[model samples]
Target: MKKLALAALVAVVPFAQAFDDKDEAIAYRQSVFSLVATHFGEMGAMVKGDKAFDAAAFQYRADSLAALSKMPLEGFLYPGADQGDTKAKAAVWENTDEFKKRLAKFQSDAADLAKSAQSGDLGSIKPAFMKAAKNCKACHSDFKNR
Candidate 1:
């Protein structure tokens, strides 16, 4: 009887406890990545001449992207955080050492982009954007679906 009661309690405890659900974590990360894409698109439109190059707006958008850059990695910290519409590969959680190095490069690239964005020089911003965008693409290529 005691063993039965303990088993029942263990089963019920999981339901009662507030836990960091992997589904929710994946959803949150997806939302953040969506934001990153939006900002990336905005910058691309300007850089590619699809829209007028508004330096101030570009700076603001670039800065926003840089600030948001630090967020998506946090969402990937949990193991087995797979759910929602995702392109993330298992290596994001499994091969963590390589992922960390890639993440550091991304962060560095974003910082450079942000600094160049403030210069209001299209040439500077262009090179910086190229580097930052490349870093983003490289990570996606390795850890996300094409």
Candidate 2:
């Protein structure tokens, strides 16, 4: 709760600074998403039955993902952040309001998944996980390059 929020803020603030260089901003967001991907992938494995579902582990990953979901947007705020050695589509900057709406959805979806995972029932967890995963895919399709 408080600790998780504090940790997220601490971890994000330095990297997601008002960037003097666009590359730094790109790197910051990439770093945040890398962590997001790690947690999301582990949770996916459990959700897909590729890994044994450990309730505690699943909950931990979900919490981590929820916290991580809050960090990346700051990195995208700087000027020219979209023009860099990065995979972000120009639409991310050009269509800022829509991109932000998608991100807000992602944050809400991740929070819902975290809430579901906290219940420790695979049956309850699955739908929430799928919803969050779907949000991720949608954002990527619109805003990221292959």
Please report the candidate that would top TM-score against the real structure.
2
Model 1, 1-146: lDDT tens digits are 99999999876763322227777768778888898889889999999989999999998888888778766766776556754557888777678899889888877887888899888888779999999898888889889976
Tens digits of per-residue lDDT for model 2 on 1-146? 99999999977766536667888888989999999999999999999999999999999999999988987998899777878699999899889999999989989999999999988999999999999999899899999999
Model 1 off-target regions past 4 Å? 1-19, 83-85
Give the top-scoring candidate (lDDT).
Answer: 2
Clashes of 1: 0
Assess each prediction's global lDDT (C-alpha) against the native.
0.81, 0.91
